[model samples]
Target: MVMGGKSALQQSAERHLWMNFSQLGYYARGKKLPVMVRGEGCYVWDEHGKRYLDGLSSLFCVNIGHGRADVAQAGADQGKQLEYFPTWSAAHPPAIRLAERIASLAPGDLNRVFFTSGGSESVDSAIKLARQYHRVTGNALKTKIIARDIAYHGTTMGALALTGIDSIKEPFAPLLPGGIHVPNTSVYRLPPDRTADSLAEAVKRRIEIEGPDTVAAVILEPVQTAGGCYMPPPGYFARVREICDEHNVLMISDEVICAWGRLGEWFGCERFGYIPDIITTAKGLTSAYAPMGAVIARDAVAEPFLNGDTSFLHGFTFAGHPMSAAIALANIDVFEREDLLDHVRHNQDGFRAMLESLRDIPIVGDVRGTGYFHAVELVRDQDTKEPFSPEDQVSLLGYLSDELQERGLIFRADDRGGPVVQLAPPLIAGPAQFNEMEELLRPVLHKASELFPHAR
Candidate 1:
């Protein structure tokens, strides 16, 4: 069937496309959905031909920007050479080369790569690897995973168990067991009596409470993404690393969104000055040009599985597809060629300042995060840092979310931790794109402040 115009597209989408994490009822009720048709540089054009600045980098995955014909062509060329191949029992050239490349770039001794289809699978794979690593080393009871509160890991059963958000996990009761929650390093919301080190110490306390022998790994993002780009307090990771080492627990850096220049480094852990026993990454690995994810294990972590006839005992069919691997190689090439990491490092301060300028707004409570990733928290009382009621949060975020998009800006208007606007522009975005974001944000947010006056 030949696809028609926007109406037909919307109709088909409403009929067939069950979008992930979207309220299908809205589209079903005939609300006009923005159908993005094309993307280039730091912008994307909807089906109506209106262009919007991609402030969230297309869900924080499109790091090198979009519409790179060269990268797309690389996949096409590889498809022509070898359309598909599996990484189980046998290996292919693209997978082999990409693994070697990733191993070289990963920090410390994280040199072994196990490929998966996306972030959720990578996380699930890490969970399994951590458990198996303990079991093989004669400690079979170590199966629990300790993760931060309100952190979004992934949607798979194992990954969902690892996720800390309560609302999303409630519906899927009886999830994989042995998943424990710890406090995240959200310093903005830190109590007056508590220091940042206390957050790190919470991990130690949780480990002691749970018994070290029962905990297999402690997974964390360098900069927690879901709870409004929560940055790790100073010495947080260093302390966590020490705690994990002392307890013989594996440290897994879940860099699904933080890696590949999102935080001005090849890996987010590098930005925080720590190494992990395993690193589960995806999204920007191929700049989301193709579906791919990997669990990078430290040399020691891989040792138990390598001995004699022991194997990982787990695999995904399309984990290391040739074309996806080729696209990832090409994506890495784009990163190096454009010096995207250096680009983010050079301009991160400017980006932060732009967001910081909004703090004067009556509702703007705090501005936080690092590199291209940042967020502006909305509040009902600036002086008290009082958050909006659930009803008000829905109203405020809904208005701001719609207004921002209608005004040609694409970013995240979230209420995960609180009412916050998350911004993570493409690495290629500079002052010009920053100004575009500010231009779009200033008027809309100011209006929101006026319209949704703080209830005294």
Candidate 2:
């Protein structure tokens, strides 16, 4: 029940603009791109003027929802005062306030905030900082990085080296050196009788095999985003923390998608009841109205940078844009005024209940995630929990993704886990929106099975 979007604007963009992360050949061939003109609350309208629900929060940003006069006005006011100022050695009011506010939200003396333009930049910055920090502190050989398999750090060459998805990085061969990957704590694929303790042990053993003295950090998402919205069994994170403590590996919790009330807390580290040495965040910082990202370092890492000739030696030009900082501060005000964190904690149970109802759907193998972020993992066999092969994955996503677009809900078709539909709706999403999502997904999911009759 949605109209096919765009005509003239699509024609113009196709001719003039080069889109990023796209199948250019297919897009250039006659298929019109749906130009998103504007967003309000949880919905966005296309160029042809058809509205669709923003289930992914426009890339898991927009925590406080959309079209807020307060956040927008803060940017305008800051622009009037001082529109452009670099964050070299000089400091600004908005950036200072945002840093203080974020420090308050972050756990365990994670006081240092290094700003960036977006999540990828934050990852890249954090990694370089970790590498340099160890080099200056007499552990230069500890420069090797160990991140989770199937983990997505970022897209930049440096960050991409840390990423674990081979499919994405295969073309960019001979990547940066010494970046290693340990098995993720995804219990579904592990030993049949694996408990939380065993999974943590497996990760620790892998770290030992790599020689802990050589490893620098372990970058992880509190709930894995790429591989079908994978959530670790309980006690997984606490044990990871313990292993890192015993081996002296820095734990970098990538909260790009889980921060800012996404996990019913300011940071996913706090929500999951563990502390990480470094935290990378973006997306929901200014509710997607502005691009911004930050790397918060704990006292252990920041202390070394305080004195001596030690220097991290890296940063971005638009790291802390005045408008972005000002807008982010305003966004924080909105979180406080509306009690958005508590709102997420209150509503998450209802949201999970609604999603669990889809378990009856033939292809739904599992429904997992936390707070405002969740995903439905589809499989070929529900009981045996057998996933379709890679070839079948393309067919399902190509068919179902567009079908869901027709159903008026926008989400991620993550084939990283057979086929998963990632849902990180705006923090403003509640029972009403949850019900609508379930209603829309059920029939369409049922129809998806029809295309793969042999599998089921």
Per-model clash counts, in order, read 0, 0
| Residue 151 displacement (Å), model 2 | 1.3
Poorly placed runs, candidate 2 (over 4 Å): 1-6, 191-195, 454-456
Which residue segments of model 1 deviate by more than 4 Å? 1-6
Q: Tens digit of lDDT per residue, candidate 2, span 324-398?
A: 999999999999999999999999999899889988778888888889888888888888888887788888888
Instruction: Give lDDT: candidate 2, residue 227.
Output: 85
The 10-residue segment with the lowest total lDDT in model 2? 1-10
Residue-level lDDT tens digits of model 1 in 1-456: 224434777878888999999999986675677889999999999877899999999989999999999998999999999999788789999999999999999999999999999999999999999999999999999999999999999999999999999899999999999999998888889878788889989999999999999999999999999879999888899999999999999999999999999999999999989999999999999999999999999999998877778899899999999999999999999999989999999999999999999877889999999999999999988888999889989999999988998999999987888899999999999999988899999999989988997844
- How close is every model to the real structure, measured as TM-score? 0.98, 0.96
Task: Estimate every model's Cα lDDT from 0 to 1.
Answer: 0.93, 0.85
Estimate the lDDT of model 2: 0.85
**In model 1, which residue pairs have backbone atoms overlapping below 3 Å?**
none
